[model samples]
Target: MFFKWVMLSLLLSRSLASQQEEDVGFTYNGFRGVNMSLDGIAQITESGLLLLVSTTWAQVGHAFYPQPLHFMNSSRGNALSFSTTFVFAMFSELTTVGGPGIALVISPAKEFPGALPSSFLGLFNMATIGKPSNHLIGVELDTLQNEEFNDINGNHVGIDINDLKSVEAVPASYFSDQENRRIDLNLFGGQPMQLWVEYDGIEKQLNVTLAPINVPKPTIPLLSLKIDLSRYMVDPMFVGFSSSTSALDVSQYVLGWSFRMNGQAKDLSLSQLPKLPRRGTKTKPNFLKIGFPVFGASLVLMLVFIIQFIVRRRIKYAEVLEDWELEYGPHRFKYKDLYIATKGFNEKELLGIGGFGKVYRGMLPNSKEEVAVKRVSHDSRQGMREFIAEIISIGKLQHRSIVKLLGYCRRKGELLLVYDFMPNGSLDKFLFDHLSTTIKTKLSWNHRFQIIKSVASALLYLHEEWEQVVVHRDVKSSNVMLDKELNGRLGDFGLARLYDHGGDPKSTHVVGTFGYLAPELSRTGKASPCVDVFAFGVFLLEVACGRRPIEAGASEECHVLVEWVISSWSRGEILETVDPKLEMNYEVEEMELVLKLGLLCSQYIPTARPYMRQVVRYLDREIPLPELPSLSKSISLPSEMSTCGDISMWSPYYLGSTMSTSSSVADSLLSGGR
Candidate 1:
């Protein structure tokens, strides 16, 4: 039992020793409140009060008074003070928020209990200080220098607190001019690490140590502290350190006092301390609330990217459509569709060659009827303008002499024109082929005269009748398609030019075969109806003399047919110039009339040439022939002339030897009426 009592006594002493650390307590009085997480705070009432405290930071190494340290929720002016030296020592010890600066300020209470010992209650200011230069043992307040505020050099100086009463001993010379006495206060270096205070009591004495680890030992002046008791007070007053200048910067700091009465300590652990609360404010902070603006920015960026992507996609689609139109719009045809129609463009169904591309015999789909197909080459010198001109001009054109255009196709950069297939083939084969009997048996003298008149009538219509006056810039005999009935049908319009009434037939670059080009093409650089008339003149001589424009072996005589005709007509030898095969099947008067008109149309000067209308009139006996000039000079064919814009085909199976002599091959080989 005695041993148990000893152990119980030892435990009680340990508890009392810990409680002595915070023996100074405070009383709150004001319009403030404290709401704690736990039941760890007190309420002030008129009857009595209970103290509650926090112990989160209570151990000696690094203790913190986690708070709700507030005044009581009452309207009267509230004052609180630390009432014990043990509490004041909490300020002197080290802390995380910084510490070791402490003080004491006491004031007499307005009302005290009659049965209790009345004492002063007040606040305090914790600060640091040093000793005076006069070798005084404690703080000296009177020796502090007082200077007037000035702005002579525009430098900042300390503000004067003259009206404030000095209630404690001001430590002498705390603000020293000595550079070695300055404190860096930086975390990494040596700091002026000491604590001192001004006492408000009449007794003024101070003791300081450099390193306080071993309290029984004392180190000299890295710094020191002093005081003066002359101006000490018993009222609520400020008691702290002051310097002549503001150079004292420390890392850890605190401001509170230790309570003492008759030199006796009190039990004031964290659990026994009063709580302090804070007042509320009106404004909220700006940095914490940003929800809507961030969402809005994200939405705007998404919309911009979407719009840009859509615009780029649309532009790419447009470019693709444009390229398709350029390639296939003119000739719309499917390869399979065309293949079935032409029997796969078979060689046995071949018709002839055309100026722009190739011609083949074909049959339309669904209806196995025969037709002539002309397909333009992709690399043909001509482009889409030429293709459209052939399609529109040939389809809408009308004349008993004009070839019938059925339909056309444009596919994959290939242009094809379908027409009524003429089985008799081309005029060149008959005119130049020895084996062809179409020329001898079919083209009689009367037929030759009628063919010339028919050709003249077609030229007149092209130059005058249509809404658009058509100039057959290339009017060669091959361009004229003749049916089995010997009817002349003008075909091929790749080089045709359109002219309105009252518009001049402007000469263009020479564009027809040699020997058919106009004499004035070189000097004038123009192509007109007169150019066609020149080609027609050659056509007339070909029918009359039965010879090619430029025969192979004739050489000087290779130009025989034209030379003979020009020479015979000039010397009045009409019978000799006429085709020998005609016999007496044609009239001399009609032959003479056509010969004169052909000569007039082929005049060197375009102005000297007669128009097709006049040629037609002379052939039909409606107009009289003008006085003729002697053909003194021979008319030679132009070596280089422009090609006519007509396209035609000749059956290559009936190829003949070169046509240089009429006797070697029958005149029946040639029979076109362009």
Candidate 2:
């Protein structure tokens, strides 16, 4: 019955299009005669429903009015008052979380060429989001919580201008006059809902109101913002709807739509609106519907279905596109690419294992370049976007003393970070594994001193020279990776933090290796450049003395490295603490200087520690070493030593990132408004 009615209306669409624009606006009562351009999975069903997308995994859909609409006055150069209303529904069959979201977009043209799917909402891609040339405005009815966008929750509405990050956002809710309270609306509840978007040129105000399809418009808007839309608007503009299915398998539809340029939009006729079809009913072909049942009756299809379910259940995590990442070029690697590179992460290709996860050596098929991939496991699902963002953020750092962060990959829920492969492995092997047959000879004292200096230079770059102050929360011999030249390049940044140069340092959980933690760090939980200095001091003592900060000894001798070094200096035999492995073949002056400087940097008071800049100068002999604070003043040492969990394995926020960017998910948007 409905199909015949729609077919009749489809014939009258051209004539009705002109007639429908009676009150300076157009109305799509049932979209039967609607002239809308559809792309991706969007189509007008036989039952007259405007279906946006199907259950495709990672895809985007767009539907726009056929002709451009005049949003601004040509003579006045000001945005004109306009209003729009639409009835929509989103359905998710297999997942509770429905979609990345849907957006009502005002764009310069009908097509968004480089737009991305998933969290980007198909309105913009990472590179295009904040460009002024975009001339875009989107009112997003977002259904999933994206840590990268600082969304309040999974269900909310936001106003985004030229950026995927919202300018203003709030939980999805509307004020009710009858109930005399606020009513929350679920965007992905699979029910029809009405939404109104209005803009006033004079007041420079934008308001959005939402309600159940059966209810009247809400008295108070769900989200109200004061903004001059003229900045994002041009004379001839196009309006449309955009949606992208995400981790959740969701289908979206529009039942009716109405719009006006200079006056109130025409009200949609509830009785005339298209009926939303049930899943697999009118949407799927009649032959396919019956074919599945026949196969199930014969038990073969049932067995196949059972086996597929079991396979999916065993996999544990789905291979969502965000898991592998979608951006092209050097910043990200597809999971399939990485898997093939590492030959399925074979045990034979294993490099080493650390606190975070396992590391594998692989060769890129295209470049034939050897790379090291670290498989890191994370506990939070909400923070993956921000995590990948930071991975891209820090991958930009380039320095001879710092290992390059190539990119990252996600596969079967495993998070993999890729880096430039260091052939010589870590510094700890040469320093601590001298007895191993492969390491028959010990590292010369000159090389040790040079390694110390190289590490100091890298620390200086991280602390004072880079665009942001980076605090390497974990600094030890193991993390100092050695390249082909045997030069020490600081590598592991899993626990590092990026902070503004002049800003107050934020508190972090006490995290780092067991013995390298600073005295003040354990108590205050604040991470800064000073704590890094303390850890570097421990590294100095470890390298020169051929021992760790805390060793297996009596309880009182727990912090033997600092105490033994200090006692040797007091007895006028500081050289005694030098590594026996060197056989005393080292510069006495340089060795003594390193021992005393280590003591100075490891002072109990954080203020007494030399900055990385000062440490660098002292190593270079750019300045004379200052007098010691007092051998009896006590060196910084933790009463108890135990490893803190690898923070790289933690949060969506509450986790940290590089400079000028919000370290937490609560404010993870890039630096820009709207």
Candidate 3:
């Protein structure tokens, strides 16, 4: 019963349209030199209209009636209707996935200002890709599957209200004798197809019918919808065909077209329409005839230019390296090789994270040697400069107590540094993992003592034993790694600076872990070997107490570990400050000596702190402990040296000032003043 009613309504609409000859508004049998606007590469040919040229990788074409149609206040009625029939063909030379397809569009403007090519069907772009625009409506013959737009398949027809996403769609086919036959049409396969679109103003209905060229029009339309165009369309609108192609290219052409408004134009005779032009005979511009050879030559030249650029860049990069960088002992690993070694930097291989970046566990392919790869964050302001500094500072320096830098890698925005994997991890984990009950090796007092002595040795080498005085700006517990045997190896030279024996180490930036920063450095923004000593002092206290340098929950006087130890010592309760986890098993006198030495090294006055050499000797029992001033009697730094002042005013001379040979040895060691 419903099918009968639908067939009756369609028949009545056609009959009424045919009878209203006097109400005709406009008509077109074909687009041959007609006054129509074209966008992209659309052109009028002797046969019909070619919407998209076949030679381009991606293209868009649009054709619209030169005069806008009147749909707002027509003589027939305020409401208006239209009917159009068109034959289209798509062809591609390449035997690959083809098409993007075409649309029968009603738009307010003759030219789509921001329409995009490819799957967008020359209608939208990233800014408005999925949004409605220009009060547009389209009946689309989509011949490509776009997952982002939820296309049904490579061949389907859709009704797009305003956006590219279809409101209603179905596979491109027509019903014949109560059986549906799929359209064997492909844009690149040169199969021509026909479509009929009709709108009824009174019923506000849109009907679309389709069939093969040789087959008769089906009794039932492939799709029908009751859509009110008055709400989406304006007074003057362009009725046209729009089509596009993407990387998978295809040519879309309209051989014949007919459109009638006000339900009055005569129906087009499909058999009488001119045939489509044969392939390869279509006229092209003289320049386009030679474009292939020109494009080929241009592509070859571009390839050569790219190769020369890469070669020149490599040579320039090599030339830019300092003489010392060329002699650096560390190997330079390829970024791809390291990326594969770390299993593409999967989370499962992540070892730890620091301020600058994360560290991952990896193994070399040839050697199968375990390594730790530090991948620095691209946004870090200091990461690149520090990477270069680390290579220059420790690339060739070898010592048992210093962690070896295996190699480095740079690719695009990524910076990676490779080092031997420390199975035991960093010291902070052992120092702070007080609540975990999981079975794992713990750092005993003896191991802690050995680590302290080893770190001291590393510092001693960096300060005086090496050819240059190296100032490690960051020396927190996390920067100290533990080997398989619990031996300490100082690592992370991202902030280290090098200076000759009598040259100044001018530093501009005041950088270091917050709790470990020397009091004098905050005010001066200057770094010296004494800064390392102050940080080591904080590390020593943390190791002995098994507590952080700064704790929020501690009593006011005990907020800082240094203050807490000093307070405890003043009250004749120094032993009480030791880690309870040690269970009184440590030697009492040695613990007291180390604790006091840490306090003496962390004094507010920079000159009061003992050198790394003296501390190492004290730890090794090679020298008797020197008399230390009581905490109250210790000299204090000037008021100006209390906190970092305005950093913008800090001079760069603090980083690389020249030094005079006549300067005192103490000044040379503490401030790089020769």
Provide C-alpha RMSD values for all models, in order. Answer: 50.2, 20.1, 22.2
Candidate 1 residue-wise lDDT, 448-558, digit = tens: 667777778888888778777777777767777667787666666656777676676665534455456665565565667767887787777777666766553454533
Q: What's the residue-level lDDT of 359 in candidate 1?
A: 78
Is 1 or 3 the stronger prediction by lDDT?
A: 3
- The candidate, 2 or 3, that scores higher on lDDT is 2
> In terms of TM-score, how similar is model 3 to the real structure?
0.47
What does the lDDT read for residue 345 in candidate 3? 83
TM-score per model over all chains? 0.43, 0.48, 0.47
RMSD over all Cα atoms, model 1: 50.2
1-674: candidate 3 lDDT, tens digit per residue: 99999999999886775555325454455566567788787887776655555433356788877777766543344447778787777776444445677899888876775555767788765345544455888999887777556788877889997787788999877777446544444444676777888888888888998877677777888899988888887767778888876544356777677777756346556665656657656442334233346568777666666666776565333322334445453466766567668897878998876645579999887788999999753423444555575565676678899888777765543467888889988999888886666417777889989999999999999988998888888887899999988899999875677778867767555555656877676457678888898888888888999888866456656666876776576567888999988888798878887887777666556665667887887798877665444323223333322111222111111111343323311111111110
Segments of candidate 1 deviating more than 4 angstroms = 1-338, 367-369, 378-383, 386-390, 412-414, 437-440, 504-509, 523-525, 558-560, 631-674
In angstroms, how far off is 277's CA in candidate 2?
39
Clashing residue pairs in candidate 3, if any?
506-654, 506-655, 506-656, 507-654, 507-655, 522-644, 663-674
Clashes of 1: 44
Clashing pairs in 2: 653-665
Better of 1 and 3 by TM-score: 3
Better of 1 and 2 by TM-score: 2
